[model samples]
Target: MPTFLKPIAPWLVILFPILTLPLKFFLKRIKKTREILALIVPVITTLFVSSYYSLIVNGEVLTNTVFKMNNILNIYFRVDAASFLFAIVSSTLWIFTIIYSFGYMKEYQNKDRYYSFLILALSVTMGVAFSGNLLTFYMFYELLTLITYPLVIHVQTEEAMDAGKQYLTYSLSGGALILLGIMFVAFLNEGVVLNFIPGGLISKSLLETGRSLEITLLVFLAGFSVKAAVMPLHRWLPAAMVAPTPISALFHAVAVVNSGVFGIIRIVYFVFGPEIVISLWTGKLFLVLILITIVLASIIAFFKDNLKRRLAYSTVSQLGYISLGAFLLNLEGLSGGILHLFNHALIKITLFFCSGVIYIVTHKKKISEMAGIGKKMPWTMGAFAIASLGMVGIPPSVGFNSKWYLMLGSFNQGSLLIMGLLILSAMLNAGYFLPIVVSAFFKEPITDFEEHQGFFEAPVSMLAPTVILAIATIGFGIWYHFPSLVVEVVVQNIF
Candidate 1:
């Protein structure tokens, strides 16, 4: 990283986009300039994050104090391997999402408001990623919820507003639980440092109050798991699909859902450590819950005919895989879980982008309506198929590589049941995802809707990102070393 950019690089990645909001008044005056600026902001953020790639990969932890709360409790920003990885992914993908949105939102109202909140959401996401301690994490986590609410309710329809309310109800409740859990930690330690520590902060002897400790862990897990969409808590996600496609991609694949997964990872490996968690009944219970979420979500996905709803269910199922991998409490399992963070982001985002493209071009949003649709919008459907295959854990795709690590992790833990669970989940993944591909290609195009069909495709702005991400599905899968290496470093640091 350049010395000049170093002091502010981390903050800049977040702040630059935000500062653009005020400039929106001027940018919006010129349509072409506004679009160009929107794209430039995220691109610059991505570059800034990448500039720190070597530092994070080399296992450096960068910290900068934001505020002083007292001797032991203060808000600071830190970038380690885990945060760096997430920052890069979010920043890079935000660029593509903005580009895609330009094309998708062109016909919609409140473009300025939409773009402004989008940037705010990204800023909060960066805050969550770089938060130096649990307090910092919690503060930003709460802010993330509020900032994203407008995006969730963007359409202002009855359904969209209802979904927005559900989003707030679930998210704020979960935030309260998490805050309560954090309070419990402070009480337990008199002042627990929110810093990430390898192998966790709590000692076994400190957990003598077993039930209390177990309940606290459950509170934290349940809280984070809501956004992670673990079981009954997941209804908000499917409902929130009433929002725009870019928001769906942002919530599901990039920021909102992933923050929950990242929180679980922090609680497991950083706060309580694997040894403490594994000894508690909560560990076994969490593992079981995650598995149930995986299997049940996949089954539900198989039955949903609505395209985005099915994908939403699919996000729920995939998130379970991450939690299960983390709970396995071994190096391989942890690495797999972390690796999937990136893998699933790429695969799921591509899938959502395709959904957006289809909606923009044809106004069709159901699986039943998509038969023979591939012939008209071949690139869009083709990308969708690639992403679908990746989601199913096909070899040489990012998803397969992560699942492979997860399987090995399960084997390392000597749980053949988990290994079998992977197999079953993969099959279920295919049962739902592949059918869409098959119907798009093998089935005849619905003729009653053939009123107008000739080389149909989403606009260049949207199609470009979809294709790039689709290619990335294969590119990263084939060259898995980079993500695998960083994830391995992160796991090593934590464990």
Candidate 2:
């Protein structure tokens, strides 16, 4: 813990929840007011996380006793380098989404309620990012599920409601698994050492026999898998696209899905430890499942005509890359996986946000409907092109950074088959993604396609977020050096 991080403690636990109230009740009818209120917390958050240089320098372990339960259920919070890393991603992007939602949802009647959900979601996400222990993380995790429900069902249609219901079921069931795992750990009654820093939690001799270890591993993987949007359990993600575009960005890219990946990371590094990850078949299992998911989801994505559904499947595949890096159980793989958690979020959210912008302006859904769309909505299509390129793992984009590490990790493992599979997956990614970009920009305009003639890329608010994220995707990708200092802070205790 660094001293600069101490400043972030009060911000996450106290000021964060306080920031949401204004948007939830009083700002319900006022879109402009709600947007203003949304800025305060995340701005504070960014300042806090970006202060990593100072925090690490001062060597302050910023821990807060938020509350406690039965001595065993201590509700504490901390924002070490690991916590700040995710916190920065979630909170920073949230500011963009909140801004984007302002204009995106302006036409909808319930602007106030929409803003409220955004604030609550951000709060819960921050809590998850900064949680000190499994118990604290679970509490915030369940809260995230509940808070984002309204965002998912924002359309208030029967379809939206169904999606919301199923979404809740998947998320809550995952949470329950996590809860059970926590209880089991508690029953073992290890002293109140709760923070989730990666590496071996206990000595290898403690659970080296690997029986209870496997059962607990199942609980941990199943719980986090639901959020990671892994295969078989990922049905809710595409269905949940009934949510507004900003919400979709929040769920798939930034807050919701990342939380799952983040949880797996915590389990691997903190709960079980990297030593445990390597000692058992856990590492092998993680690699196997992630590779299987990458190929399976890519195949499924090719058949998806619905644009959002395609993105959803691609998401599952991409999440596999993140999960795979972790399972490789090396510095390159783990660091790449951890960093990709943020990089992918930026790229995917921008892609979805662009799709939403098109839908908002032209009511287009199927890729077939987007022919010559670039002519009508140049800005949106341009942003779409860049974002899609990023998704395809092209150069000068954040997606490239994640894939670069994935490739390096694979090579480091000397796993030629996984490397080959990675290449094939990238090609598959290009196959599905290129056509959408090409259709939008290269194809001749079809007369029958409806164009809100005057409409151009939703609104400035929406367009701005998409552009910013798109630029971020490329900017971070090109200059991509993980600040050695930040890494030192984050991975210090683990490695």
Query: Which candidate's TM-score is highest?
Result: 1
Residue range 37-141, candidate 1, lDDT tens digits: 778888777777777777777788788886787735788778888888888889889999999998999999987788878888888899899887788899999
**Cα lDDT computed for each candidate against the true fold:** 0.88, 0.78
- Clash pairs for candidate 1: none
Top-lDDT candidate index: 1
What's the count of clashing pairs in each model shown?
Answer: 0, 8
TM-score per model over all chains: 0.96, 0.92
Error of 2 at 17 (Å): 3.8
Candidate 2: C-alpha RMSD after superposition: 2.9
lDDT of 2 by residue, 248-331 (tens): 888888888999998888888777777776767656776688888999899999998888989999899989887887787777
What are the runs in model 1 whose C-alpha is more than 4 Å off? 1-9, 448-456
Error of 1 at 491 (Å): 1.2
